[model samples]
Target: MGLQVNIIKKLPGFELRVDFKADNDILGFLGASGSGKSMTLSCIAGIVTPDSGKIILNGRVLFDSENKINIPVRERKVGFLFQNYALFPNMTVEQNIGFGLLKSISKVERIDKIKKKILDLQLNGMEKRYPYQLSGGQQQRVALARALVVDPEILLLDEPFSALDEHLRNSMILQLKDDLMGFKGTSIFVTHNMEEAYQLCNNIIIIAGGSIDAIGFKDAIFNSPPTLCAAKLTGCKNISKAKKIESNIIEAIDWGCKITFNYEVEDSIADIGIRAHYLEIMVDDEDVNTFNCWVVFTSETLFRTKVYLKFSEPIGDEKDFDILWDTSKEEWDLVKDKPLPLKIRINPEKVIQINRN
Candidate 1:
């Protein structure tokens, strides 16, 4: 079964208008802060109401404005894991997990259900601990246990891993992935982290300016972003204004260079994007897009070295535009002793054409 959403809601300064559908696979809502990713999840979970449109899950109508149907939050059968875990401070882990179960169920049955959840989340001995007494990972597991105990039709996560430190975040991510494997419901993960989205989601929806910019399988969207915003959000560092000059050539006005594309150049292409890692240091000017550049700045991390460079040939009266290039530490070591006035090659095949409209 799949989830379908086509909704609109107006806020004081922003309006959210999104429409997409997802199957039982994990779907990601990838966006920047305040871009409506969490709001979309809230609408799905019945935490927030859309001014208009419909939401359907597995053929069940969750919200329909025209038909005047709005399911109550409790009856929606959707589980939500908030950014802060949202666990009761005073409640024991056992009581928190069993909170959603019906009161009519016998005490023994409820205890059995809670026991199973504790075992599944590896929270067996911590069942009586309070939220504050447990570690970050344990608290997260308790939240997940609470959400999953009721067997929701849809699971919604809003920046669920944002509060953890690096080590704990990675560990919890793996644990969450394992726990989600046996889940029989559609899962929606909302996040601004590109790496997390790519790692956890089977499909991704890129939201920008309170609207969906693009939605597709993870690899397709990352490899070939359809819009300039999409490219930026996906971490494309080198982008320039482009104008089509010929069937296979486009001039990047900002970079003061012309790119020859093997694919047909579209008139609608308003920009060109190139990933930082795609720019290769030129040992010799043998490539078609090879150009002379000056190193403006350099920075290095443990794994990779970052170089910022500007085109040697400046555009008329305009400030020089810089482009970022990243090389692995291994590659950087070989060229660390290279002379000044660096020359770089732009891989024509790796260049991405973007249509802003």
Candidate 2:
């Protein structure tokens, strides 16, 4: 079964127009805050009504604008896992899971089915526990079990692991990935984390300014984003303006010198963006595009080290650039305060030069 969304809505000072399709794959909606990612999910879940268009799930028309066909949320057979876990506090875990099955099956049958689901989610012994009794990870698992207990046709998870600690979040993400194995139905997962989006979804859709900026396979969308905004959204920290010098060469004038890259720019306005990981820190040598840069500052992160550098001379009124390096603690310490000129390797394709109008 697949999910299709062709919808339009006009919000205060913003218009959301989204069109996408997904098969049984886990599709991720990636966008920054206020970019309408959450709003799109709400519309699909029937929580927000769209001004126009249709939503179809598994051949069932859930919302059709022309015919005024809109299904109630209860009848949609969609399992929505909210960001807050949203477990009913008054009811025990078992009761909350079995709540939806009451009308479909007898008490005994519902209890038995819920018990199986609890075991499936590894929450068997937590049956009588309240929401307050479980840890964040356990509570999230219970929430998933509760959603699956109803045997919903599709699963919609909205920032499912945002509330957990780092360790717990990673563990829960792995668990969720495992749980999706037997789920043949489609899933729409919403998140702002680029790593999470890349790790979880087969197809990634990025939204910006209430519209789709880019959408494709995880690698394609991140590695070759369609616009400067898309590159920035996908964790590109080093972006510079460039002008075409020849057919297959573009010169970045702002990066200390006229660094010619092995890329063609047909558009008059072109911007090149490179991820920090792609940058290097070493002495400037005979490398084709090498330039002199001085280390101005350095900082360390959990997994990588970052160093900010400034150019020897101003170029196009731009004074400096920052280059981040991902290295071990020992490696970072060796160059902690050293003044060095670095040669950075550039992959022509990875260095995205966006054509702006």
Candidate 3:
């Protein structure tokens, strides 16, 4: 079973018009806060109604504006794992997992089902613990078990690991991956973290300004972002204005260099985007477009080193540009002593240029 949404909605300051589809796949809803990610989830879960359009899931009509058909939230049979890990404070973990089955299943069957789910989540010994007695990760696992105990047709997770610290978040994400592999059901996950989206999702839908900014596989969406907004949201740190001189000739005002790309820009107005990871400090023998730059500042991360570069002349608003380069301990030892001038190159094909609408 999968999810489909072709919907339009209007609020005081936002307008949402999105059309998307997914198979029995893990679909990610990615956007910054207030970008309609959660609102879309609510609409799917029947907590919010759209002004018009239809929501079809698993060959069933969840909401249809034309037919004036809408299923109540309780009847949707959709599992929603909320961001807050909404477990009952008074109930133990097992009781919480077995709550929905109270009237439907026999007491013995209910206990068996709940115990099976607890074991699936590796929470075997924590069944008697209350919500307050568990850690954040444990509480989230219990919430997930409760959602799945009903054997929901589709699963919806909203920022599932946002509350955890970095280490715990990574661990939970891996656990969730394992659980999903074992469960093998359709899921829609909403998150704002790009790394999370890349790591967890099979497909990505970026919502910006209440509309679907872009949608596709992780590589397709990130490799060739359809718009400036999509490129920015995907962490394309360097976006510069460029004027096309001819089919492959363009002049970048920020870099003050007229270069010919190996690829063609078919648009009249283009915003060139370069991801920080694709750029590097220029070496002496580099044949690419070499620019003279002075290191303004530097910071090291676990994965890469962030170097801020200042051009010989001011380059518009981006006078200081950030370049991320992978470094080893030996390289760090050699380069960390003093400020050094740098050179960087960007692959032309990697330089995505989005045309303004």
lDDT of 3 by residue, 199-307 (tens): 8898999889888888889888888888888898888877778889878877777766555676666767577877866764555626555555655556887755766
Candidate 3, residue 70: the lDDT equals 94
Q: Write the residue-wise lDDT of candidate 1 on 100-142 in tens digits.
A: 8877889898988899999999998897789989999999999
Give the total clashing residue pairs for model 2: 1
Q: Native-vs-model 1 lDDT?
A: 0.89
Window of ten residues with lowest summed lDDT in model 2: 313-322
After TM-score superposition, the amount by which residue 26's alpha carbon in candidate 1 deviates from its true location, in angstroms, is: 0.4
Clashes of each: 0, 1, 1
Q: In candidate 3, which residue ranges exceed 4 Å CA deviation?
A: 285-288, 313-340
List candidate 2 stretches off by more than 4 Å: 102-104, 262-269, 313-327, 336-339, 345-349
Best by TM-score: 1
- Looking at model 2, the pairs that clash are 282-342
**2 versus 3: better TM-score goes to:** 2
Prediction 1 TM-score vs. true? 0.95
Please report, in order, the local distance difference test score of every candidate based on alpha carbons. Answer: 0.89, 0.81, 0.80
